[model samples]
Target: MNLRRLKYFVKVVDIGSMTQAADVLHIAQPALSQQLATLEGEVRQQLLVRTKRGVTPTEAGKVLYGHAQLILRQCDQARVDMDAAGRGLSGAVAVGLAPGTAAAGLALPLLRTVRARHPGVLLYLNETYGSTLSELVMNGRMDLAVLYGGRVAVHGLQFLPLLKEQLFVVGPASLPAPPEHVPLRLLGEMDLYLARPYNVVRKMVDEAFAGIGLAPRVVAEIESASTLTAVIADGLGATILPESMARTVVGACKAWQCRIIEPVIEAPLALCQSDHLPLTEPAQAIKEILLELVAALPGSLIAGDDTRLSVS
Candidate 1:
């Protein structure tokens, strides 16, 4: 009925246990149970059913849960609206960044711009992988995220295309230059430095090799982009990475990048936000700053058209 009760209900639903919810909400288990009981009595419906595994929302509870989320979002929006009316931008914004390309090259300058333009806005950044970041945005844990294009389908989310980065063949500069742009077939025998299976880039690389009818021989599986680049620079193995990552390596190591021919894989980067939840004023301001930063980068760099370059 009230915002406080709705917030508690949401927390309980998210945590899926009265005891855990009480711990998170900083209330006694008895008090939390009593509150849910009172709420159920008022609504004249069974909201939750307990099972050995955990608590599950009843049919009626499911309906109420949906309404509860909307009400809580509206309450938060009201507060944000009032604050924005008095001050231009003075609220918190939480933004998530996926690993690989966007986090390193795209997000930092935008964060700087937001700090400069809206000093009152509190910025929170989380470094996460693509699929996880998408779910976080959908569940209202993050206001927005920079994500890889083909990996996630943001069902009820708005996506703004930021840039497109092509895949590159990376290795030590001391190695023989692969005839200008190297074809995928030429690298079939090379040992590959790859990310884990869950990584979006790793999946893309797998698909690319499959498309070319060549199976890559992965020598090492690394989670961090910098580590992969370091291994490649040491001539331990070659790698297939985004052009953004290649630029990053060229700046940090003695590495060279060759464009992948035949199936030139280009991954698009997008600014994603939930369509169901409206952005706070602070979040909107941050989004604007990010778009501006993307626009300011050179067309080739922004479009992932830069053939070879060091990270700026």
Candidate 2:
């Protein structure tokens, strides 16, 4: 298949409108449609369907879209690698750090370390949910990520266990303070604001609460950092978070934090990357520095024994 047609198809799928995609691709709409049609013919599948809402991919198109992204990414990386073959390591390395996880702490240091070591290399720091990071890494859009969970191995990716982060109960200063190390059962009585059940830390919090046969009285579910900070600053409710994130949250919102005792809840932190897509020189250097920083993290909670897992 032609790389140009695959690029056109991806652009169309991304924008979901033939006209909009044409505009973004800086081509005529009819010409863009023809290219897409040629791509569909080459693949022998109805890749897209016109919808009242715009263009939607067919089942086949969805599968193609995934592979198309990976292919385009690899092609771009190859060009970059070849161009810089003898010019010293230089290329963009996208590193995703799931916000509110232990890895969020690495952003500034990673940038600083990379800047000091490989001035030619560029770093892209993305702070988002782990699921989004995992999807990006799997699709080859991201070079690497630092996130929690992934105890079971995921195909095409690798998880290098870095640390076991403990959980904390954090709240604004206006609210009555809890003990230095509060029991897990006490959380059942507290008004809480937490992420949805899908979050890795949320799953750990849920399991811990379930073990005590009580549900937390969550006043609201907050996923955004800005919104969560506002809610806590207003003393709307307390929240349960991993130790690293709890410190960040408390520091930002002038909140108080305490460890969760009785049954100490902990989440695994891991360095994730594509097992098959070997990193470039610069990316490998960044990975090594990242591991060193995580190792020297204050109050180190290095993960036990389990060194490998899949993204799932």
C-alpha TM-score for every candidate: 0.79, 0.87
Q: Indicate which candidate wins on TM-score.
A: 2
Q: Which ten residues in a row have the lowest lDDT in candidate 2?
A: 301-310
RMSD of each: 5.8, 3.0
| Candidate 1 RMSD to the correct structure | 5.8
TM-score of predicted structure 2: 0.87
How well is each residue in 1-312 modelled by candidate 2, as lDDT tens digits? 999999999988898998999999999999988998988898899999998889999999999999998888778878988998888778889999998887877888888888888888889999989988987887788988999966778777888777788899999999888899999998788999999988888888888889989888888888998888888898888998888778888888779999999899888888889888777777787787887788787655444332343554
Q: Give candidate 2's whole-model lDDT.
A: 0.85
| Shift in Å, residue 67, candidate 1 | 6.7
lDDT of each: 0.76, 0.85
Q: How many clashing residue pairs, candidate 2?
A: 4
